[model samples]
Target: MRWFMWAAVAGAVAAVVLAAVALMFAGGDPEPAGAGSAPAIPAATDAAVSEAAESQVTDAPSASPSSSPSVKPSPRPTLRPMDVIAGLHTTVRELVQDGQLKPDAGEDLTKRLKDAAEKLADGEVDKARDKLEEFGKKVAKLREENKLSSAGYQTLAAGLAQLAALLPSR
Candidate 1:
């Protein structure tokens, strides 16, 4: 037990010394990540005056003290419910054209999806989501009735699930 304690103390001291040395070598402070970022520290004291010759690509040319890029690519846009509905409409059309889905069923599904998209656009999110759920049930029924290929049904069902997921919850 005594030997174990001595070994642990020695290890802790060594770790502390190593960490201090690493921090010193890494520079006094590291830059923080976020919107309000400061200009990068110059590699050398004299390098700051020759920034134009450095050939470094900055986010943008700024006249301000802050060198951080102001405009980040609009935080990756998420699919809206209407967008999902449009995709479903296209999928239904494709399946119909490929003869994997019945023309009548495809037409009906397209109409339902169009209505759902319209409803969502009109601020009827819950109603649109309900319509989408019903549409999914209809797709399942097509599988049960053997009116659609398994693969086609799976694709359609997945699209419906995705669209439903995009809808805002009640």
Candidate 2:
């Protein structure tokens, strides 16, 4: 009947409208359900009706830019020599607590870090640099003796290197 064809067309139009609205809310382009292919309309439907439905779906407005929030990266904080020494101290203490480093070794390393910090605070750049070099040597020896894990050795060595770079050249 003529009424049945009109109803089918109306239903298809409503479905395309709903899909477009859903895509807008999802923050994406309102592409048709099956791009480059005929829509799933009844075989009795006319080509004109299919073409109209496809145009309605494709011509729908795209998602708004304001739908998604923009993000900006925060600036990285600069680390001072004393800060590196403090981090090294914490790393050494953790290693000792985890049984990765013997208490004696940890205590010695911690003392060296403390001394380096104090020397740095007193404007004794050379002395602080010497302490950092000593720490690096001790770390290497421990690694060679199998007393320090490779991870532990790497952590301490990197911290020492960073601290040395922060200090003034001899």
Candidate 3:
């Protein structure tokens, strides 16, 4: 009878220890918002993204005829400086034609864009990028002075951002 009582106590202690161990292995609650950190991604969403990426990897055709298939990296085409400058000019022209920007501002921006393109042609890439950044600032000031609509500002900003992406980072 005494041994039976001891066995019962040991079983209860073991159960409590197991429960504590499980809690320790489980992660704590997620951090609250406004904690000055990135928002936490849900576990399910992360798993889905991982699965999608893995499927893409498996779908790619094998490159070589080895015992195990190897992933081949596809080559991405490089953008030339002039090509990017031209794209900016095209976007600006559309904005002018749409009457979303003042004629004077458009003309001034056009001239500055042409100068930047010329700099790129001359192989002065850094100078060209500097000119582009300067032009972006000018456009922002003009948007404020003209009281451009939100749509107009977004259009101009998008063009500037696209051009900026093509330039090499300082």
Reference-based TM-score of each model: 0.55, 0.56, 0.52
Alpha-carbon deviation at 4 in model 3, angstroms? 83
Q: lDDT by residue for model 2 over 1-170, one digit each (tens)?
A: 64345435434544553454354447654444587688786655578788887787866589776756765545445557787788788878877766667788898888888888888899988888887778888888888987776656666665665666667777
TM-score, prediction 3? 0.52
By TM-score, rank the candidates, best first: 2, 1, 3
- Candidate 2: clashing pairs of residues: none
Error of 1 at 94 (Å): 0.5
Q: What residue runs in model 3 are displaced by over 4 Å at the alpha carbon?
A: 1-74
What lDDT score goes with residue 53 in model 1?
A: 59
For 95-123, candidate 3 gives per-residue lDDT tens digits of 56666667777788889899898888888
Clashing pairs in 1: none
lDDT of 1 at 91: 68
Error of 2 at 141 (Å): 1.3
Model 2, residue 119: distance off in Å is 0.4
Rank order (by lDDT, best first): 2, 1, 3
What does candidate 3 score in Cα RMSD to the true structure? 25.7
